[model samples]
Target: MSQTAPIRVGRIGYLNVLPIYHPIEAGEVAGPLSVVSGPPAELNRLARAGELDVTACSSIEYAMAAKDYLLLPRLAIGSRGHVKSVLLLSRHPVARLDGKAVRVSFQTHTSVALLRLFLERRVGIAPRYESGDVTRALQGGERPDAFLAIGDEALRLADHPDYPHRWDLGSVWLDWTGLPFIFGVWIARRQAAVAAPQAVAEAARALVAAKDWSAGRPEVVARLAAGQGGFSEQAMRAYFEGLVFDFGPREQEGLAVFFAMLAEAGHIETAPRLEFLDI
Candidate 1:
């Protein structure tokens, strides 16, 4: 616990965030920042615990800890429609699964919340759910009635023919609200933002610049995503292109819609008031 360390930054170490981290990944970019990478859930926990000064976090985690964090403007992992990852694969028709058990990935919070909202609102049936490694559960000879997989794993499981009913949560959200679905965002600890305003702003600059730099080189991200997960290069290309990294008005509206639904369904106490870094 180095109190005097330069802003401790965190990011999800997965292909989904390549556009934002590509410059850093290329070993061509350096700054007065301590970068710590982990899975989404781990990063979220580290951010909430104040171990990370700034982190790429699940929107659900941001919503839950809104008072302690300030969103870094103009960056996110969201999709307008047909996100190739973030899947809900069911053994039975989704609408008919009333009391069946489902396994959800332990690494995602936003996706799990969205899964519940979609199940109750769209399918009108609330199935029992447990969090675990979906692949491990299946490989261990335990077949849950249904399973939710997100990120790279979802993209891989989608090609399986046994799971006939595959639902892309992002596409469902688009269909439900005609807006983009935001899964993750970069948030700064409020105290860190106030005490190290320049550092926070500088980090924002680096990240936004990294995003711009990667935006110009989609081939780099496509190749990385495709090769890492054994996913089709064409599919990865489309996936990378389909994602919207901006935290503009339209993206905010989509988040508002999602929070409202989560609140109405009692998944959360209320929708959080979004706060951004003063920079």
Candidate 2:
């Protein structure tokens, strides 16, 4: 890429991240940035392929490919508890779903891993896992015993009458470990950071500025995000309020615990050291 070329940044196509991306999209934070939007899994793939210079991707993806990326400090998508978005909807109790078919969303990697840890380690039930279109299945009135949903889909299906039992993965993890759950984090590709240090730093600063701008105006952010996921303004406000956008000490500690558990459970080969960009 040319030195003058714009930095290609990946944005997660979920309302949860609107506060960060909306400002950048609206030119509130100025930088030579070209934004690409996609689901979490797609963003992870692009980041792994070196297609995106900077991106907010699944937390697990960062660990799996930590050598290729440097974390952007003070930015993450996490929850102290009750993340309302990442949910496990089931017809039966989670502990009783052994051997039953539970459809998992293909749009997720971290949530699926977390769900596995929850069921096998915490709930003590191993359900048959299959990858499928959970939203389509639910819309078509084809209810499997259970299904995992994340992002806007989870928010939409959170109160659906068909599934009486809903488990918030964030809350479940918090209860199990007494730590926050970091779903996603902003990262810069190592090559990008090394090749265009100033560009990467500018992009990182723009992201922090955007977050700061959104911090003082939750109602405005909520209003902007309303209807993007069929959620009311009030609901969006509450959802945004529940999310933690800072990658502080507590969030890092929580992420460390999660990575350790993922390694212990064989979901990952090994726990990775969190590598952050100096800028």
Candidate 3:
């Protein structure tokens, strides 16, 4: 690659990723880099198309694309315990979701599939899925008994006190596997990490630094979250404090359990061995 080649970085447009990209946007960190933001699905597409050198992708996409990618070290979109942003909103209780109608977000298939497995294998309920937004599906139509929501939308649901019943998937995953749930992880082209080790290290440093800075400063979080995801001060604070970024050994147990569960449920044909690219 030429020196002029922009190091394309793919990321999701959500509050969960604010720390990873906020510094780049704020000019606190800089180098030969470019940021591309979208939903998890779009990021996966970009990474698969060779349009991105590095991307924070959904766990399912990472497993599917494992043959050609490597995980970025010490970085991820993780939750130590409960993450309110990944949720299941229901008009009825979760126990009543068996064979119930549910609207699913196509943008977040991995989490949805995992939830399905939990309810089936763990909770012993198998629900039917439909394609539609939560609000639209419940608008006097075949209302979704429950809706699997993620990212900024799920955060909004967390703030909805009147929503009555909801389940934080992260909490459920942790409860079952006794580990944190990592929703997104940074992945790079298999060749890129080998050929451009310095660049990869630089990128990892940038992300870690950005994460540290954002964690300590609520001001930065508030500014970025407000404009990027319409996240309020309270919500931003919760996001910054609740989500963990390090993808080190301490979190590997959780990640391993997650991969195993996905494979067992047939969402992933085989569990991909995770290796954090040592920068």
For each candidate, the alpha-carbon lDDT, in order, equals 0.84, 0.91, 0.78
What's the C-alpha lDDT at position 209 in model 3? 80
Root-mean-square deviation of Cα positions for candidate 1 versus the true structure, in angstroms: 1.8
Reference-based lDDT, residue 119, model 2: 94
What would the per-residue lDDT of candidate 1 be over residues 1-279, giving only the tens digit for each residue? 233457788989777887787686576455557889999999988887778988899999988888899898889889998877799898788887787887888899999999998897888887898889988877788767789988777876786666788899989999999999999999999888777778877877788788888888888888877888677778889989888898899999999899888889888888998888866
lDDT of 1 at 115: 92
Candidates by lDDT, descending order: 2, 1, 3
The 10 consecutive residues of candidate 3 with the worst lDDT sum are 135-144
Q: List model 2 lDDT by residue over 167-209, tens digit each.
A: 9999998899999999999999999998999889888989989
Model 2 weakest 10-residue run by lDDT: 223-232
Over 4 Å off, model 3:
135-142, 159-163
| Clashing residue pairs found in predicted model 1 | none
